[model samples]
Target: MRTGEGLLGRLAEGGRRPLVVDSSLAALYAAGSLVLGQETPAAPWQPMDALGRVLILLVSAALTVRRVAPVPVLAAVIALWLGYIGCGYWPVVNSPAVLLALYTVAAAHRTRTAAVCAAAVGVTWVVAGLLGGRYTPLPAVAVQAVAFPGVVAFLGRGAGVSAERSRRLAVLTDRLRAEQELRAERAVTEERVRIARELHDVVAHHMSVVSLQAGMASYVVEVDPVTAKGALEAIATTSREALEELRRLLALLRVGPEGEPEGAGEAAPYAPAPGLDRLEELVRRVRAAGVPTELRREGTPFRLPPGMDLCAYRVVQEALTNVLRHAGPAAAVVLVRYAARTLTVRITDDGNRSAPADSPSTGGHGLIGMHERAKIYRGTVSAGPRAGGGFEVELRLPAPHAAGGEPVGRPHP
Candidate 1:
């Protein structure tokens, strides 16, 4: 059985006062039979006789089986006692078998069934007592029968309630654990997306610049030796810088103490991050890509947060890519201005050539990614075709480190 039921059964066995009471009563009956006058009973019906000893032994054994087969065993014990009464035996004071059977019925069965069994046993006890010349009032016998079953039923209900409560607690604990795991997984997913977007923006912009300068250096290797050398140098510097940044990002995936010295065999070469100082080279590469562009800077330059610099560079890169893909070989202008508390970047292209209908729209994840980056730095972005037949993208990013830096009434024109 379950733990709760087992505990109740053990407790019931412990509280068996009726068994002790019956043993004492049997001793009294034996003493009375031994000392009484010869005229009291000279036959086998005497309590000290073999037949009486046999009846007592049978009743004692029946008490043990009451818990296993209560109702049926109770019936057998009652029938045996009725036979003793018919054979002229006197009624005993205590009946352990009858008391234990009542308790078992209440503890193991439904309330209604236990009540019926208790009543039947009580009536049989009283009727047998009357036949044996020891009748008791009906009301007194009924009360005695009901008491044992009632106590057992109460104990059983208590055990059942405790079991139900434990089950509910277990279910609630599991639900809470599941919810915590889901939240942790969601957090990891969001961090990965943020990292991927940053990597894409960083790699794409620098790679585009390298491609443009490399192509230029190849074209003018002999025809324009001076310009070709300058282009090659720019290409080499850009490539070195890109490699360094990639290594730094990869290092983030390692498990180690911060700033620990690398072993000679473990040392990995890397490049430094590029900032606004390289804007000139970036512009030249776009120009070489056949999209004539202009680069302008305003306000006093100041240090920028690393994330902000990366985001600014990505916005420019994505805008230029869109122009090359969808704005045809038209001229584009890039303007960068630092004001009281904000930095602005605008790229505009006059749609003079018919862009291929199959060209992918700029309103996809590219624009969404840019918007997400801008929002990280407390900024806003607007992009669409201009009224005069050109596409324009404007971004405004806060620059807290710059003098006069603050959010503007609107993005710079």
Candidate 2:
């Protein structure tokens, strides 16, 4: 690994080798002090003796744990350096370790505490420099003692501030990422529910017709060949339509881009979703399934958003399918009404109210899906037996003008 990367990794793991740094600093100070003591003319610069060397090594060794306990390390180093100075040795030998301890304290603590510590250290250094007895000028000694520690403390405080900002930014970025994932999961759940409703509507409606026609064809095949042929033909057409609708739904679940295939616009025209415009065909299918069905419209019709249109269509389709399955030997009527700000579709069937408790029209997924679809547009769904003794499902949706462009694709009444 690169030198910088290796250092960063060590820091990240909380395993920085403080001993290596301290040993190197200790060696440099010991050798520098011996050379300076012999050459310098200052009155306080005494030759490096065994005691002075021991004191300097003690101060340097204390700094190995400087970051772990900066305040204690600073106190110990200051005490050892004072002993060295009292022995008539230059105080500069141990000054680097003192400054380093102050820097650590500044970075790890509050600004006021670090400032107080820096000021105390400066005063102590100034007194030690004065012990040189005018060898160094008073002004120069005071400035050196104060300015060096002050600058190191300032840099340490800045590092602390920068580290805090980085930590906060990391936390905020993680929170944002979590929220985005939550939203994505919620969207996926909603889309799955919609697709399931579509599948239920498509499969349930077409299969009901196919099943009924197949039964009719089998029952009348020996007695009436012509009628049997028509029933068989109806089953074939219903199954084909069911397959096409299923393919469309499957297309939505595909993992790639949802745009049409290359050259599809010309090869195969885009098929619009089922909507109120298909009510006539839906009614006819129900009529063929041996349920007399009627279609009616009131008020001026208007275009609808694709989602709202599909919602209305599915309500009607699901309601009629329930009629076919449970409302035995009955008739159904679908009414679509357009208002200034709302579109309503009501499907009623004059069927037996005594259907089994498990009927899809009564508290089943069909009814629940209707309500779910309506709620997406701030709409409502009401389904229950009417006062006049027939099942009814009504959907009322907010249909502001902004939801669509113009009135078109009106279903024939």
Candidate 3:
């Protein structure tokens, strides 16, 4: 009736419990049989003697291990039942123990094996009926023999089926939960990588310019007041721009419950991301930092997808920053080519000096960021010291047929 309430259920509760519970069951059954045997008068049947009492105790004790070794226990209990009957004792006193053994066997084994056990117990009952029948009718004995074991076996089969289904459902639920956790962890790792890459690009580019302007301003403060004043102004303007870009990056972290910005109602909208169209402004800034820079366009230009546009612009900015920091006294030229199916940007410097051991152009975080950004668009970036002089970084990206490329809705940092 309950989920796990029968003989087999009690045995499966835990290790060491079956022995205690079954021993108690056997003791109760033995005591009841002894009391019943003493009360029965010596009429319609001979009264139980020492031998009959001993057989009843043996059959009750066998019930203790019915779940552990069901088949052997059933055989032993049936043999003891026959012995008790042969001693001229009423067979009904031992019938309950025999039927309990039959149910134990059915619950513990497959249907075929349980059915075989049922048949064996049924035959034993018929034998007991024939040998000990004093006043009971033969037809009634025949019906009892077949009906009792059959119904018990049927109930035992249902218990076995229910237990198996519960086990399988528990396993499936655990497997699905583990898979969901794994996927969540992977998504978190990817988002962290994206944020790290964006932070490196933004900080490296802006800091390089700030460092150059500050140094220039300090050098000319007393010698040429006007030149020094211009340098200081450039430094302040560059610092303000860097702060605005950092604010944009921080905006990515202000998420609300619905995935919108936390202060969407009060805060101003974010400015547009810089793209190839901003190359002229970028070149002017580098030139003002004492690196004579030229921007050139070869092929016809057209609008690109938002994701690809950002990727292209970041690559160029990273390359120029590397040139300013590593290629000492370099004059840089940036060439942008917008072909029918591809976009390529190449930045080359003409400094006679080789980069220091830890320069970004000489394989550092800046170069790595460039390559990572290009990869998002199925593009490639190559950077190294040019054979003639200075360093060069070139990137190539394949554009999709439609304007739609990788999504740009990803958080910047």
Candidate 4:
């Protein structure tokens, strides 16, 4: 059976094929009829003429196209079978051929077509029995004639429907698998783009600070030793902070199987991300870098969800960095407000000068990164040239009830 299945599989590989499986059964029937005619004196015997021989050959050969052209081949074979009977030929020899054709028709067409074919073939069988001068009782003729043909048709239709359903299920499974693969690929691509954008923001802002400080140290070293030393110290401080941020970014990229970010041949440090608590330190460092910066709180302060805290910190850091790099000699104000529903951070630089060519509002990644970060918490940030001859960046984040609280207080949780 396995070998036969393999052969049919190979046959279907090229295209559709009828593969005359019933022709052998037709030949066996003919041989059995011939043997019975010679040995059994009581057996029904009807000799065939030229027309009957032609009809038998045609009906048996028509089985070859039965699978490919089921309805038409069924019609042709049944017509030939009927003609053969009318010509006074042995009817039993053609029984297998008729059965094969009826099965093929029922398997390929709808139930209506199957019912029509069943009725036509059933009527033909009755007419043939009556014409053959046999003493078949009317009730026996009705039961056997209709029941046999109808049963063959029903079994064939069932098998055909099951095969078709299997085919459709295989196709649907393949399509779903393909769609899943495409979604995975798209997710990977989006993650890569986000990583690239983050690296851009980190390098651009920190390197700008480092560059300005190095230039000041170089120019003042010959005449003002203390001032140049202070500039060198600022550069060292900025570089250290930049390196720490880079480590965090690298850890995010190379997360290990155990949910740990790995870097520097070791597990990432357990240092908490900078948040509102680091605002004073951030401002101190910016002031040391020669950008006058201030931090002010207008309402009761609270801790935030980890992701929201990181977003808030990054937005402030980016905005201050922009002031140092793009706003010439600007004194920036950082304001934090804890409102009923939101935590707002507003940074405004007092420099009336136009922003630099690489400003975030002019097709730069810093603003894009800030926007992306805010989106994570369903928050928003707006930045533009202020009407009062300066630049301002304001961000508002949702202060959910559970996440808004002082570290020591229950705060209505």
Candidate 5:
């Protein structure tokens, strides 16, 4: 994002390999001396021979492999340059090549190998100063010998440390970025699943009731006018309730600040959330759809925590809806049990025996959602065909030390 960061990223992406660049630079420097005929002044040392020219080429070439094989490059370049010095030639072109290899060794390899190159450089420098006929005493030449290579080694080691730190930091930054992206994706998935559950409860339940009542009204309009009129009333009530629930769900999904929906149609007022108190309404709807479902409660009822209440209500709603849709002329019974530490729900219906269409074995999303809801309260759910030609769904939720409430109201006939 910043200028320095952008430049570094582009450089890493666009640059040639390190080996290529090193070889090119070393060759350019060598060509200036070897090709142009400007030789370094080594007075007492003899002129360059054919063997010495060959050694110069070898030293230049070895520089290319410094990064890839630092230890081997150091050996080859130093050996060639030492031979060039032994063959009565002055320390000039090949000397710098040896230094380059020493730097590479310190920069790329371990401390032990770099130490070896530094010691060798010091000894070679002292030997050259003493034997080349330069005017210098032993101690003065020794001091000069150790100082230059020791300085070069220290600088190279510092550079190596910096480069290593940069590499580790880059890897850490990339890992953090990947983790952040995963967290975002997980949050989006959770929101999507919650919306799906709301849609099933809001639309599926009411639509089924409307369909059943409308069909009943059409069937008996002439033969039984009184019954037909009541069916029509039920259909009208179901449709209006469905629209209201949809509007409430849409309001819950509004982004950020709350206000009237910005659309051609005005938003509906918010309604209180449904819970066990509205259990009779759910039963009446199921019965209107021609599926006889009875709700039975054992022990005194208790007010559930808001999250637990919503989860339990949705589980019951989904189970009953599945019975009406897939159970084919079966009667369902819902049993709710309250204890000191747990609340249990059991729904059983005498339906077709092979398998219900929305069973877990069929990989239905509805069954999967019921499982998800139960797991939220550290609960468990089991849904499958029963031994006796039907299907059953059982859910248990933890409710430690939950105080009791008044008895639940009775279900409608």
Candidate 6:
């Protein structure tokens, strides 16, 4: 049985040689039938002569072509069988040709075609049995003639269903992969834009201070050497500080997996971010930029959360930067007041001598970034032109605790 299965497997692979070999095997089986019932001495069947044997061989050869042209081969086999019946051949056992034709029709044809062929074979079988008078009214013989073809048709339908399911799964898998790739690309693009905005804000703010202090130092180098020397020293310190902060921001991009190479001095720069502890220095720098600023603190001193401290510092830094850029060298006031579980910082500037005809729009993205920072710590920011003159910015941040804790100051190295 295993050897026979191997031969059928080779035949099903469908080359011309395998097909021809399968046809020879089917013909041999049919020809052997001529003598199968004759060997039973108790009930001997009539034997075929040379002509009958030749017709049987022709029918078998026709059936060898069944897989390639099932309908035509089935017709030729049925025709040969009819002729054999007309020639007085009784109870012919060479019915393997018809069985092989039925299997081929079921495997190759659609439902309607297979049904028509099955009905025709049934009719021919009944007619032959009636005419030969060797027919039995038994169910077993009828089942043998029809059951093999039905099984073949069922298997063919199953194969079609399996193929369709596989195709659908492949399509779904491809679509999901494409969607995932698109989302990853979008995320990378957004991160790049955010980093660009941060770099612009940091560079513009620090560079403006550096340029102003350097100019002051150059102008007083001969007239007031002592003060000029002090100014130059301040310039150097400010430049170095700016460089350190820039390096810290850049470090965010250097992260890598465990197996990736590490850069020299793997420890991060800029120990902890600046906050309210440096408010006096911030005021001095603004003053050096030719902008007079007043700082006022009210209520009892209290500690603030780390996130709130950072947010407050950024708010003051951006506000003063905007004042120097847009508000000109005007006098500005900085007020910090803590009251009723909230800390409020307000920076207001009077009109500068060279103020532009139109102030920069509050709806601009710089203000939007400040608002986003405030919102992160459950804070609110309001900025607009004052009623009388100048522009004012008010930022209020919620303080969860009022009792003394760690001082609201810069992080220690």
Each model's backbone clash number? 7, 0, 0, 0, 0, 0
lDDT per residue for candidate 5 within 274-368, as digits (tens), equals: 77767788888788778898988876566687778878888888888778777878899988887667888898999864446465653476777
Of the candidates numbered 3 and 5, which has the greater lDDT value?
A: 3
**Better candidate by TM-score, 5 or 6:** 5
lDDT for each candidate structure: 0.66, 0.79, 0.81, 0.76, 0.75, 0.70
**Compared with the true structure, what per-residue lDDT tens digits does model 2 show for residues 249-345?**
7655553455654345443423578888889988988888789999989877887888889989999988898888888878889999987778889
Clashes of 4: 0
Give the distance in Å from residue 28's predicted Cα in candidate 3 to where it truly belongs.
Answer: 4.6
Q: What lDDT tens digits, residue by residue, belong to model 6 across residues 54-95?
A: 777788778676776777778888778767665656545545
lDDT of 1 by residue, 1-413 (tens): 69568656754775667556645654554444334422344343444456665665566566554554556667777776776666566555225455555666565566676667766766776676566543457666556556644565456545545656787899989998999999999989977877776576657656766776777789989899998888877777767766776776665545356564243237754334556556776677677665799987766566677678777777887787667666765788888887767778898888653553124543255677789989988899888878897888898987766544334344434
How far off is residue 257 in model 2, in Å? 6.0
lDDT of 3 by residue, 306-376 (tens): 77888888888888887787678779999887666777899898886556423654346677777788888
Question: How well does each candidate superpose onto the true structure, as a TM-score?
Answer: 0.52, 0.79, 0.74, 0.81, 0.79, 0.55
Ranking by lDDT: 3, 2, 4, 5, 6, 1
User: Of the candidates numbered 1 and 4, which has the greater lDDT value?
Assistant: 4
Off by over 4 Å in 6: 1-165, 218-227, 256-270, 296-309, 336-344, 352-365, 371-381, 396-413
The best candidate by TM-score is: 4
Candidate 4: tens digits of C-alpha lDDT, residues 284-378: 87787788888888765666887788788878888887887778878999998887678899999988655653465646777778898999889
Report the lDDT of model 1 for residue 93: 23
Q: Model 3 segments beyond 4 Å from truth? A: 1-46, 49-89, 101-116, 119-147, 297-303, 333-335, 339-341, 345-396, 402-413
| RMSD for each of the candidates | 11.3, 6.0, 6.7, 6.0, 6.9, 10.5
RMSD of 6: 10.5
lDDT value for candidate 3?
Answer: 0.81
Q: Weakest 10 consecutive residues, lDDT, candidate 4?
A: 404-413
Candidate 6 pairs with clashing backbones:
none
